[model samples]
Every structure is written in C-alpha cells, then in structure tokens.
Target: MTERDELVPRRRRDRRGRGMRGPAVQPLAATGHRPPLPRSRREVFDKIMLDVVTDIDARWSEHLGLVEYAVEDAPQLPDDWDSGRVPLSSLVRGSGTTPTRLVVFRRPLEHRAADRADLEAIVLALVVEQVAELLGIEPHDVDPRYPSDLDDD
Candidate 1:
C-alpha cells in the first residue's frame, strides 16, 4: 500500500454508520448558562393544578376544610358509559370525618387543550366549577376568572 493511503485518516462512524453526527459542543454548556429544567406533560399539569388549588384555598380554606387534590393520568370509564365525552375531572364529597376529594384527569384535559395557555384556562375553569359545587355558590363567586362562556350543560 502507498504511504499516502496510510497517512489519510479514516472517517468516523455515526449513528447511521455513514458519517459524522451530533453537535461540536452542546448549546447551553458552552454559553455558561445552566441547563433547562426537564418536565413531562404530567409534571406541567400538576404544577398548574397546584397553582389553581393554592389560589382557591386562599379564599375558601375556612369553608372548605381538609380537601384533597389529586392528578391522575386518566380516569377509568366503564364499558356502558353513556356520556358523549370523557370527564376531565371528578369530585367526591366527603362525609362526616372524611375530607372532600377532587381529582383532575391529566390526559383528558391535555387532549382537549390546544396549547399551554388553553390548558391553564381549562384547569382554572374545572376547579372553579368544582369549588362552586362544594360551596353551593355560583362559579363566578368562586373565581371571577372562570370563563364567562363556559356552559354548564
């Protein structure tokens, strides 16, 4: 073999086994900025839920004592379910010595929302409606931000 052939470096293999891949340097690492936080859809939904619950509790914590809030991936529906649409949330009133529980179904709410802002609106609306039911008051009384156009029917 010619010396010239030996002097030429062999090309590095990539993911495809064809050519080079990946960035020369990771984007944020080179800039001296910290990496962005990693969050999943469920995490995002939970944060939104926490914000809404905190706001509602500030106003009605006295009237609605010992309430439990939760976020589930999706609700279990029976085969004979009659509703035209799936439920985005569920509320179970507590009896004597039991705390009331409110559950937000994350998948259904995420599916119905078009974007982040819409998701926030939907979460707020559901919480307001549930709180209204618990307190036996209008949703508007529960939160002025409750969407005016949301239909109860």
Candidate 2:
C-alpha cells in the first residue's frame, strides 16, 4: 500500500475509493417497477381539509374577510398536561389587520378515527364547530353537513 493509503483508516476509504454506498434498504415508494402506493396520510388529510374549507368559504366569503388554514402533524403538549383529551384543532380569531388562523392537528384526529370515512366526518365536524364559534352562530348554520344534520339524513 502507498504511504497515503496506509495512513487513512480502512472504513473511510469509501468502498476502496470507488464511490459512496447505496442505502441498506430501498424505499418501496421510490421503486419504479411496482405500482405507486396511494397518497400519503398527510396529503389525503390536506385535500379533505381544503375541500371542506372551500365549500364553506364559498358561502361565507363576504363576512369572513380573510382566513388562514393549516395542518400540523401533531400538537406539542407539556409533560404534565392535565387534560385527558387532546385538541384536534385550534382556531385563533383575527383582530384588526390579522386574519383568522385555523390549525388542524392531523395525528390526533387520525388516531380517533376508525377509517377514511370516519376521518372525513371528524374533520368536517371540528371545522364546522370552530367556524361557528368564530361567527358566533350555530354549527349547522355554518355548514348543513355538520354532525347534527348528518343524523337527520
């Protein structure tokens, strides 16, 4: 071995200086030969949230002024959080120049739901309830599809 080769460590040689090694396990989502999997849970949740917001906004655009919607993977809770229930969403009303901000906690809602349909129902119910609170009106007034209305159908 040359003087430089002898000085360097065996593991740091990078496969005898050929190139970097590939990952030990390939991710199935990236493999080209197989059919692609469905959209990610986050993505699906995002779409559902958008659809619900769009439908509601169309009817309330004049009064709502401006609103911001967001989705977080999970909420950060304190070590000694005393509450037994975790919040599924948060709504911060706007004042003056600030726009209303609504945030949905994806993980908590997904955890409570039994299936895709249940997730949709939960998201719709929470969003409508929050929007109603913001507007100081009944949830059914915000959206006819609110949980109460679902029972009549």
Candidate 3:
C-alpha cells in the first residue's frame, strides 16, 4: 500500500468518506428530489406546517365566517432566550377582533420529536388538536374518522 494510505486510518477513508453517507431519504410528501439533508428538523416541520395551515385555511375559511384568517409564527419573548423565550410553534390567542389567527411554534415542535417520522406524527396531531379547539369541539368530533388507537390502527 502507499505510504500516505498507511499513515491515514482506514476508517477515515471509505466509500462513504468523512461526511457523505448513503443516499438521502426524502419525506413522502416532498415534491422535488431529496435535499442532501433537511435544513434542520425545525425547517422541515415549518415546511410541513405551511402546507397544513394552507389546507386548513382553505377548508375552514367559510366555516370560520370570515374571508381572512392568519397563521403565523409566535414571537420569542425577551429575557434569557435559552430558557425564558417562548417557543416559535405555539398558537396564541389574539384580540377578539375582525380577523382571527392561529399561531404554531416550530422550535418546540422540533424539540419534541425524536426523528422525522415522529415529527410528522406530532405535527399532524397538533394541527388536529388546534383545529378542534378553535371549533369548540373534541378532536374526534372534528373528523369523526380520526384514528382512536393511533399506535395500533
């Protein structure tokens, strides 16, 4: 073997190399080719939520009795940002004004999940829960077909 090859450890140089690994795995709903990696768990969650919020707005616009509704990122509160800041994914109550809004915090949701699949499940569940609360009904009532035993069936 070459002198250089002997100097460098075998583990450091493989088909996978130092950083690159196997092919990227794309989320099922992803439209385009897979990215090298998701920008971050939070970014992926945010993208997913954007699509979800759009669908919800379209589906519930009429039921809401208003032409316009808002879905936005929650503000990060000042103080020790590490702990004191409120997360970006929370839905906060708005003033009882003309247009209503539903906020979703991204960071907190990302932090809650162990992986991408878990993140997606948590996001879906959270959306359903939020919508149910907004409509003043139980989560099951919103969609009677909503799965009961989420783990089994």
Candidate 4:
C-alpha cells in the first residue's frame, strides 16, 4: 500500500497505539464520598467572618445581638483620596429604628492577606475593632486574641 493509504488518522490513537476510536470517558471514584471542591474566595471570606461572629456572640451575647454584620466587595474611596491610603473596613452607627452595622471590605482584605490564615486573622481583627467601637471599648477588650496594634497594615 502507498504511504498515504496506510496512514492512521491522528485522532484514533490509544495508549497502546491501537486504532481505538471513541469518546473519552472519565471513571468515577470508588470511594463512598468524594472530597468537596475548595470554596470560592468570597465564600471563604464569608465563612471566616461568620465563624468569628459566632465565637464573639457566644462570649459576649449581650452586645453582639444588637449589631448587624455585612460584607462589601470593596470600600468606596473618595475621588481625591491621598495616595497610599485606603480604608479596609468601616463601622456605621445606628440611627433611629436602625441597628449598628459593621461593614468589612472583602476585596481590600483579600488583597492584603498573604494566605488563608492571614485573611482569617484580618477578618477577625476587623470584626473585633467594629464590635469594640459599638461597645465603647478597646478592640483587645472585645477579643483578647486581637493584636495589640492592628494599625500596621
């Protein structure tokens, strides 16, 4: 036979170089439960915040109930804001018929963190700071584990 007549199509090759032609199929794991996929970054951030809030609430039930927690993608920096200055978080005081609110900027915090542990620490600290403000106390007083100076970053 001529070279062209004997040639095999590129798509038909199998591991053993046999001309087995069919669609590829993925095999399912034999294990009863496959591991869950990792959570998205925003979901992880939300979970970390929720865990922190739950812990704080359990310890300080009286003050935590009146506060509302929220997460925004990022802070709205003013148009003329100075260079090298950005607000990572904020706390809003309640008005008539409104509850005090703590807002944590997710993007900024995620950008600042080097890893998941760092992100958790930053989130916890921000919550502690906002809770402290609402309670008219120091951040450390709100959570003894809070860093002495969270101002470094």
Candidate 5:
C-alpha cells in the first residue's frame, strides 16, 4: 500500500482511493406500475355532482342535454359581503341560445358539509334545484329527496 492509502481506512476507500464509500441504500419497490393514488377530495366532489347529473339526465335527457355542469373553487362574493361569511354553494345561469350552466362552488360546499355523506346530499340538492330552475319545475319534481320546505315563502 502507498503512504497515502495507509492514512485512510480500508472501508472508506475504493480502488481509485480518491472516493469514500457512502451508506448502502436499498432498492425502492417496483411501484412504477402500481395503481394511481385515490382521487382528490375535489375530484370526489365533482364525481358526486356528475353522478347526480347523469341520473337526472337519464330521466330528462332532452332538457339536460342543453345544460352544462361546472365546478368553481369558490363563489365570487360581492365586495360589500362580510369576510367571515361563506357565499352560496351553487348558481344556475343562462337563457335563450346560451347553454344553461350549473356551477357548484367547491370550497363553500366543502365548508358547509359536515362530512362526506353530507357533502353528497348537499351536491345532489344543489343539482336538483338548478335542474328544476332550468326546467321551470319544482325541485322535488327533479329529485323527490329534495326537501320541499327549502323553498322561500
């Protein structure tokens, strides 16, 4: 061994003697082909909304075909509105040649829901209300599960 080789420990040196050994690392599992992670909360919410639309469309294909469903991160509140207050969860807009669009605001709905089940109910109710508006029918006519008492006097 050379004088320089003698100064360094055997475990620390490679054949070149210039480089030091690093800690051993195990190979990662073969995860490349594994299934994707579960859907995100927002995606799950959107799916719930879509499912409601699909069910409604099956019953009223002619009416639903002309409408569009959308998701927004949050409702655009008026500047005069209180900061601590949450805005409406959904809105239906359009008329005449324009396509009727039902937009559900995700953050406000999530904030209002107590849990997953509650969120599902809230989304369904919103969809029903909007569809009823589009069809000029009562919300209960669209989805019987929608509470009749929710209508303003």
Candidate 6:
C-alpha cells in the first residue's frame, strides 16, 4: 500500500447497523429552550398537554377566530388516580360573545393511555372533542382529514 493511502483514516461503520432505525420525533417543543422539568406525572402530563394545545393553535387558530387560548394544568388530584389523568370542564360566563375556554385534565388523560402512541391518540381525541364541543360542531369537523389523493397510493 502507498504511504498516502495508509495516512488516510478508514470510514467508520454505522453503530446501529444496516437496517436499524431510530424512533421518529414530533416537533413538540421549541428550539434552544431549557429542557422541560418533568419531576412528577403531572409534569409529564403538562408537557403533553402543551403539545396538544400547540397543535390546536397551529391547525385552527385562524379558522376558529381565536385571539388566544390557554391550557391550565390539571389541579392536583388523588395520587391513586393521577398517573395519566385528563379532565375537561367548560364555562360560558360572559353575557354577550363569551370567550371560549378549554381545560384539559392532565392526569386522567395520561392514565388512560398505555404508551406514547396511545397518549397521542388520546390527546388528539380530547382536543378534538373539546374544540368541537366549544364550536358546537361534530368532532370530525375539528379533526384534520387526510387528502383524498393520499389514498390513491
């Protein structure tokens, strides 16, 4: 072998091997922010709750004509039933053109799911249900339907 060839470094092998793949990540959080503080189950639920809220804002802020929306953390509940809880309560206080309110019970929703996929489905469903209820429309109206062209594949 030539001295120049010997001087060159060899290509390193992929650590995960040929066909292995990592889990897909959703754009759940902002960039360059402090890592979320998830000490208890509530914190975990809070993070997921925020994701759902953000998704709503991204998808329907203009359509809903919403100036703003908030996701209040679920109040502390009994430890025995707080792992993945999501409780929903709504109120119409103002006399004229009352603002919409959506409260997501974090602990109960989290408890209802067995895994991340389940958690995502539950969160999306909860958001859809709440938004639909607020708008007095069917839940399907709030859900994002796939384009018909995608079904042609």
Give each model a TM-score: 0.77, 0.71, 0.52, 0.73, 0.66, 0.49
Greater-lDDT candidate between 2 and 6: 2
lDDT of 2 by residue, 1-153 (tens): 899989986786566686653443345455434545689999999999999989988898787789998999998899999999998888888999999999999999999999999999999998888888888888899988887855453
lDDT of each: 0.88, 0.85, 0.60, 0.81, 0.77, 0.60
**How displaced is residue 147 in candidate 3, in Å?**
4.6
Better of 3 and 4 by TM-score: 4
| TM-score of structure candidate 2 | 0.71
Model 2 RMSD in Å is 7.5
Model 2: worst 10 consecutive residues (lDDT sum): 23-32
Error of 2 at 78 (Å): 2.9
Comparing 4 and 5 on lDDT, the stronger one:
4
Candidate 1 lDDT over residue span 11-97, tens digit each: 655545754433434465555665567898888999999999999989999998889999999999999999899988889999999
lDDT of 3: 0.60
Q: How close is candidate 1 to the true structure, as a TM-score?
A: 0.77
* lDDT for each residue of candidate 3 in 1-153, tens digit (9 for 90 to 100): 999998997675446555644346445455455566548655676677776667666776666544233334446576656775455444444456645555666666667779887766676666766677677766665554345665232
What TM-score does candidate 3 reach? 0.52
RMSD of 3: 9.5
> What TM value does model 4 have?
0.73
Clashing pairs in 1: none
Q: What are the RMSDs of all candidates, in order?
A: 5.3, 7.5, 9.5, 5.5, 7.6, 12.8
Better of 1 and 3 by lDDT: 1
lDDT of 5: 0.77
* C-alpha positional error of residue 110 in candidate 1 after TM-score superposition, expressed in Å: 0.7
Model 3 off-target regions past 4 Å?
1-38, 66-97, 143-153
Cα shift from native, residue 9, model 4 (Å): 14
lDDT for model 2, please: 0.85
Q: What lDDT score is found at residue 10 in candidate 1? A: 59
